[model samples]
Target: MTTKANFPAAAGSVVVPYGHVVGNEKWRGSEIAQRLQGKIKLIFEDGLGLVDFHLSNRICILYISEADLVAGDDFKRRLVRFRNANSLGGIVIVERTQISDQYFIAVQKLVVLELGMVLLPVANQGEASQLITQLVREQSKDHNSNPFLRKQCSQLLEASVFRTVQQIPGVGKTKALLLLQQFGSIHRLCNASVKELELVVGQTVAQQIHTFLCS
Candidate 1:
């Protein structure tokens, strides 16, 4: 069995290579280097700013904060599309120093963590890459240690109820498992009332699940 310590670590310190771009000559070399000082610069070019960061051997990091300038809704939609399409390993939002909103603050924090870049709080592309590499290493450790967890994960994959529970408003896979584990069967779970389900899976999810199952 693969152990946690056997997980591969990210590259330590390597001199980044120079990149080629067609239209942007002035933005090359030291100018781009200055913008990417602390990061392990994988690729940087001026025209359209095609920057790719080394998140891990299997994953790469990409940022779309610049995309936000196009259209807030469109940017968010495109960001999701890009992430889904490109298999973007993580996401980070860099604020423009001028705007400050509590709503965005919360969102920023949530996105950073969800993308596995908790260490890169401010969301610099370089830092986000490094954080993602670290997260991959940590997740590798978690993946190795818990065989029972893996078995449960595989069982969930085969069971449509796992996916169905996630689609319901407030119920996630975790709560779904808790419900199944406690009830010992989905039939029992379906029979559980809103109040009884609430005791196992939180009131909000329980109520939603009750409506879903009863309906």
Candidate 2:
């Protein structure tokens, strides 16, 4: 997945979990890890083995392959771990092969919506690597912004009801669902008073969503 990339490291950078360093020639962790090594802070394990990588200040990115997605309940648990974690940037699903309907539906229902996962499925590892590098660069570009490519956000908005909720201005899936639950439906949420919405999703997001619905 190695390719030419230009990223500038700044004050807040990525924190790679575990001791798994990106290999030089082999590039075992894929080109994304290799390219991001110096640009990001690679936190080698301190005898406490953790997950693949950790973006403490940045959003969490998970490298999910179709094979991994179909790997029974064990892999499902792994996916759960990533989804439950704090501040997820995106989940890059590498499709070396076709993902079956059964697994695909499960992923959509179980992980994407419920956890507000920003899902991006790439054709191969190369695309995944490039996209990941781009995300890192975008994060570097604007420190106080959501560092998602325009295309990524568009795809997410089109994916499903859950994703659409996640795209409502500052409305993440969790807060969106909470407001929906309180109001009983999306239509109700749109019609809900700002004070009512604020009780569920907070003042800023509530106002943003009310404005969004009106617009």
Candidate 3:
């Protein structure tokens, strides 16, 4: 829904702290650098670094391979600070591989779901770059249109309501919130017929919800 002009021009306008590319070059260098060369700012630092991918001004992504979870406490701390910050754009953790049950559980409870950040498992570096670019462009759009950022910024009560409605297939945060605003509750929203929902939302979304409920 956003225009290309709204997207980051080159290497996103952010700067990665120095040393972010030094020791971890194997996982963090070359391909990642090329993808982000003109897409984000890769800063040089004399001190220790925190995040591996700085996609935008508000959101920074941390990388975790299957083997690197245990030694990432510093990043955990930065994530906490970012979570508590007033800035709306939240953290996104990009896990490079399929991790163990314990690692997944630890990340889910300690950071991802609890701290209000997104954790995505990407198969390769190329996918990671493309995904980050997509997210960055989406974040640049209006708040009403950027569902991910909207959900991230929402309060508990509203978030719960949105999540409930979003469970319907093809129902994103915007449409879910709109449906709730129109119908008042999930019971009422679900009870509405396709025609009734179409009157409020659109043909596509109404059909999607109807199909989902009926299926």
Candidate 4:
């Protein structure tokens, strides 16, 4: 119902403040929107276009009701149009009631594989609200708090670098350590001249290292 140009700034870049969500005007009093009000800050805006909800600047949601699924391929067309028009990561939330369960697999394949977007199934709007709340909570947390996003410490990085250096032909722990001391990273080690490498290992091994890396 809304157009892309009506957005505040960039396309698909809905700047939602922390612990808040921007919802489409179409869902002003919908059950999911109503439920979300108690859990997080829900702000209604017009011209959200294909997005039903904006979780963050980079993430958004497109809701497909059970009726939409049963109606025909209109939901698919809507998803395709959204994919073509927006750069934001879309999360498709579909109502998966017993009646709509039959179409779940087909919908999943279309939304996930073909469209390359996330597809989440909910029994009803209540469940959808709960899932959305969890998603917003996760998004609000510090990235380090998430196990998948926790940064690899320098010690682990150095160990990984150490192992990678040993993979070079004819280089073992001692030589790997020597080369690492001379060249702090694999990029520098790969770029080292034979004369440069000779400063770390002997001239004979240096040539071998240079050839192994370059060739």
**TM-score, structure 3 vs. true:** 0.44
- Overlapping backbone residue pairs in candidate 4 total 0
| TM-score, predicted candidate 1 vs. hidden true structure | 0.36
Weakest 10 consecutive residues of candidate 1 by summed lDDT: 1-10
- Worst lDDT 10-window in candidate 4: 147-156
Query: Candidate 2, residues 1-215: lDDT per residue as tens digits?
Result: 22332221221243333222221222335555655565544333222111343343344445656667667666567666655554444453535456544465445544454555555657666676566556556645544544444445445534554555666779777876776568764456657889988888889988997886666
On lDDT, the stronger of 2 and 3 is: 3
Q: What shift in Å separates residue 119 of candidate 4 from its native position after superposition?
A: 0.8
Give me the candidate number with maximum lDDT. Answer: 4
* Model 4 per-residue lDDT at 36: 84
Model 3 Cα lDDT, one tens digit per residue, 35-133: 755664443322223445444344456665555565656556766765665343444444545444345545543443346455565666677767666
TM-score of each predicted structure versus truth: 0.36, 0.48, 0.44, 0.62
Per-candidate Cα RMSD to the true structure, in Å, reads: 12.2, 11.0, 12.1, 13.8
lDDT (C-alpha) at residue 211 in model 1:
76
Clash pairs (backbone) in predicted model 2:
17-53, 60-89
User: Residue 165 CA error for candidate 2 (Å)?
Assistant: 10
Using TM-score, give the best candidate's number. 4
Model 4 residue 97 lDDT? 90
